[model samples]
Target: MQELLEEALATLVPSDAEQAAVAALCDSLLARARKAAPDGVEPLLVGSVAKGTWLPGADIDLFLRFPEGADLKTEGLALARAVLPDGEELYAQHPYLRGSVEGYSIDAVPCFAISDPTQPASAVDRTVFHTSWVHDNLTDAQRNDVRLAKRFLAVAGAYGAAAAVGGFSGYLVEVLVHRAGDFPAFVEKVASWRPPVALGAVPGAPEAEITLPDPVDPGRNVAAGVMRDGLARAVLAARQFLAESTADAFVVGAAERKPLGCVTTVVLPHPGGVEETALPHIQRQGRKLVRALEPFGVLGSHCSLGNEGFIVLETAVVELPERQLHRGPAVWDAGAFEFLAAYPQAPLRDGRFWALKPPRHLDIASAVQALLPKARVVEGLADGAEPLPAA
Candidate 1:
């Protein structure tokens, strides 16, 4: 296993030239941000690029530091403009500009440069502490561990915090490797992971989907963005890799195609929005779609898109009956009167009501088609978008 991991790292580790080129871009952006920054403030380089744990083709994150209680919207945007004039504006807690520079995607974010991690002025303020901690603590052996872990996750389609991936972030993987002692140990730990895997000395009921407390901020979870589906897939990957204990398992990813007998492509029209904005919107829509299909027994589903305003849902599911059970309000509730009026023959089950009514959709295709009119049906479901219903 150790030999396999070492071999993987040899190929996974970014070449010196690749790292140098990326570093130069970060240094240039940092210098530019610092130059634009006001007196007593400077730009701090952060992210995987700064910590020397980045893989090839990683984005550059340059944060302009400001004092606490500073108007980051005003100060940050101004410095971002000064550093790089042309870029797309993005928003989370505050506004930041993002664009490509020297063939590399760059985010010129402005955040509070505070010394303490506990009291972050903004959402990104704790990033400084995370970067510092990882840099200072990650050993040479552990860095390679991270490389192997990231490569494994990447191949398994369980790597990234981006809405599109919703898997593991490099930082989270680093935390896991650091906590588990090595790459192989991390895999061993993950093989035994249940749905909501918590790590790094977190307390509570482990209720928040997946809780990985930030080492810098004990109250915050670093793995909050991880979608449960992604974690499940990663867990499966870990078990499989461990069972095989081969390097090949960490390199190739085989798509799990939905059963052809009852599978379909739901091409949802896009709003032709920006990539950054459209992706999160699409991911949210995917969640909504899967939930809507749960009653019909959706075996599996995934979101895929290739063009403008184009989203596809490959879903496998059991067929919806002509009459589906719809739950009604509580017996004593005021809304129960209206609900009973809608379904006059509804049975009073316990304190609640239940009704067998005509399903809006006869099958999977029709269900998705029905969803087109109600949900974020910006452009509506595609013309041939069909849902595969199970018998």
Candidate 2:
């Protein structure tokens, strides 16, 4: 196991040359930001790079800290824009600059230099404290453990905390590794976890399937974004790794698709918005379609957003029954009269009005088209469509 972990680390950890290049990029950005900023504004390095736990090709997170009274929405964004003139402004909690520089993705975020993490003026104010906490608490060895854990989760398709991914965040991985003392121990612990797992004594924390209160801010539930299925995937991956420790465990093999029945693919234009915001919207649309297609015996679905977005759905029945007995309100209810008025020849069965109506959509493709008028619905997957992940 130790040998396998070491091999994984060899591939996971950034090379010295790569680190040097990233450091140089960070230094240049810091200089540019400081030079462009007005008095009382401090430019600081944050995120994985500053904490020394960043993976190879990790996006650089550079925050410009403004004094408490400064307007983060306006002046903060202005500062970031000034620093990266070519960069595009994207909104999350607030607007920030995003661009690619020399093959590396860069984000110049503006935040308040708040004194208290617990009393953050904005959502991102606590991030600086999180960086500090990790630096103070985790040893060099444990940082590597965090890298291993992160890669493992990524391979298992359960690494990111994005609304689309609904999985663990990098900071959460650090905290979990810190608690377990190392990567192997963390895996062992996670393999035995049941749902509704709470790790800290945080008061008034919102209930979730997995609750890990943010150590930096007890009021926040760090694992609030983690979806149950994503957590289950991580747990199963951990169990498999424990049973047979091997380097192959760190690799993401092609997803084997064993669809139960008919497959329907919906292709649509990518919703233009910040990725964090757009992805959730796309997933919600996919889920809404899935629910609508329930009568067609929906088995599962996968939604992904890129240049163009796609939603792939599997169902036991491609075509629903032509005539459906539309149930109405009970005879004793006020709505029953309205139902009878609407369906003059409706029959009364089991004390409820029933109307035999032809289904609005007989097939899955037509159903998808009806739900998403602009979407291109295919009976099976589109040509060259990516396979759905393993169940």
Candidate 3:
């Protein structure tokens, strides 16, 4: 994994200046941790930092572990606040513990034991934190190798892409990390992961990639691709297939009633069907899907059929259907394309018929504005907006 990730992030290493800053930040945090828990406190770097795979705009992730007898909730909070006196304020809830210091968003998580310092965390008390006893019992070196593999996949952007396809969560990394003992074995497994056979967008085009094994009950070839193309493409294709195959995509966004500060949506034309019928079905299905998807965490969905019967998947904003025509799949000419393309909202890529993307940032108001140009500013809502879960 180290070999693979090093290759991908070859173009993504932090600059000397950035590295120095991180080092300084890590040192200060560690010093404070030690001071906070007079009796030894161990701090482990997790997320992109310890993984050695940070990209531009990455945040520093530090987990402070209080051996067996320390009080994590009380001590952790007081000490964190003391260090950052007047920095930007941040709130906290379950699983993740957050706060900001020196203007940088600082996420401090408490743990009982340090599994793979670089992998996503599992609360020690939960069996999920550790994995199959076999994988969990791997030697330190083997675990380090697994960390390397995760870094490699993450740097290659596979991890982020997978997260986007499915719901982005620490769990994906956890699953891969546990599979590390058999690095070669797991790679093979991931390579073989394929989407369901019935999920074809275009009748006979090509099967989409399902990079992870669980999604593909029977799986594909992990080491199938040589160098770069194989693994990356496979993972991306699989995600697209899964999005189409199951209602996972719709469900994820649907679970969130209101935009939870960040929103991402993907719209694509159905490859095989007619424009007239397909278009309306796509829009109606999309909206219905979003509402059905709410329990899974989606706020809403925006969908439209192109004049040519293409499926347009809109994310972030939830717009109602403007017209109810059933003409040959709403086929469009250059003029109609021009008008729709120029809609004040964010236009997807040029050649791509539809799009699947997240909000520019985790700012709900900004995301809403980007999605709905016609939406008027609602003052009281902005000031009284509820807090969202942490990243």
Candidate 4:
């Protein structure tokens, strides 16, 4: 296990040239930001690079820290735009700039650079402080453990705390590694986790399937965003990786939802006019479609970057028949008459009201499209984008 892990670290760790390039990029961004930044504002390069846990070819996160008097959004955007003129203005807790620098992706985010970590004003404001905490607690050897843990979670399809990924974050994995003492130990612990696992100084009912509290902020749940299915997959992966100890168990790839039936592709035109911003929403929308498809017996799905600038979801379910029976409450129930009235021809059978419901739509894509107008059923899809690939 140790030998395989070392091999993985060799491949996953950033190369010296890549490090130099990222450092130069960060320095350049800081240099550009200092000129346009408001008074008393500071530029800080945070994330894995700062903590020495970054992977090869990973994006750089450069944040502009502002004083209380500074308009963080405006000043940060100004600084970022000055650096990357065509940068798109994005938002999370606060507005930030996202663009490419010399073919490498960069996120120029803004946050309140507070004096104390415990007194952060916003969610992301404590990230740098968290990075510092990890750096202080982790040794050079432990950083390797973090990298191994990250790859393990990622391969298990339970990595990333993004809205789309809804799994574990690199930082969360790092904390797990620290607590468990090493990568292999971390796997052993996760493999032993019962559902609703909580780890912290104080543990109670878990807020999520597995609860791992933020070390810096005890009140905050670091694993709050992790979904049950993803965590289950990670648990399974840990067991499998323990048994196998093979590199294949830690492959860098997206986890595909297991297929249940004939796959249906839901394609939407590129929403953001650009790929990076649009792709997340596309993947998110695909997950939403899968959720909506559950009632129709859809089991799982896979999202993809479709050809011709479209976002695609190849799902595991297809359309039902043109019409189906909808069972209603008992004849004496309050809503029974209402169901009869709505269906008009609904009849009592075995003391229950039954109605032959009209089809939502004969075509699955059309059904999804019709539903989208009444409700934005998906997180990433913009209004008016249609689903495609009939039948």
Identify the runs in model 1 with alpha carbons over 4 angstroms from their true place: 200-206, 252-261, 267-284, 294-297, 304-359, 374-391
Model 4 per-residue lDDT tens digits across residues 1-391: 7788888889888888888988888888889888888778788888888888887777788888887656766676777677778887887777887888788888888788788765646777888878888888998888988877787777776788864456888788888888999888888998898778867643553467767668887767777878776688788888887777788766765334443355444556556534435667666766666676654665455444544223333444456776788889998888877887788787778999887766666655666676454322232332333332111
Ranking by TM-score: 2, 1, 4, 3
Where is model 1 poorest over a 10-residue stretch in terms of lDDT? 382-391
Shift in Å, residue 298, candidate 2: 1.8
TM-score-superior candidate, 2 or 3: 2
Compute the lDDT of residue 151 as modeled in candidate 4: 77
Q: After superposition, how far is residue 173 of candidate 2 from its true place, in Å?
A: 0.4
Better of 1 and 2 by TM-score: 2
What TM-score would every model get versus the actual structure?
0.78, 0.87, 0.40, 0.77
Pairs clashing in candidate 2? none
Predictions in order: lDDT: 0.73, 0.86, 0.42, 0.71
Candidate 4, backbone clash total = 0
Rank ordering of all candidates by lDDT, starting from the highest: 2, 1, 4, 3
The C-alpha stretches of model 2 lying farther than 4 A from their native spots are: 254-260, 321-360, 382-387
Off by over 4 Å in 4: 32-39, 201-206, 254-260, 268-295, 302-363, 373-391
Best by TM-score: 2
| lDDT-better candidate, 1 vs 4 | 1
**Over 4 Å off, model 3:** 1-8, 38-41, 67-73, 86-104, 112-192, 195-234, 237-391
Clashes of each: 2, 0, 34, 0
Score residue 98 of candidate 1 by CA lDDT. Answer: 90
Compare candidates 3 and 4 on lDDT and give the better one: 4
The model with the greatest lDDT is 2
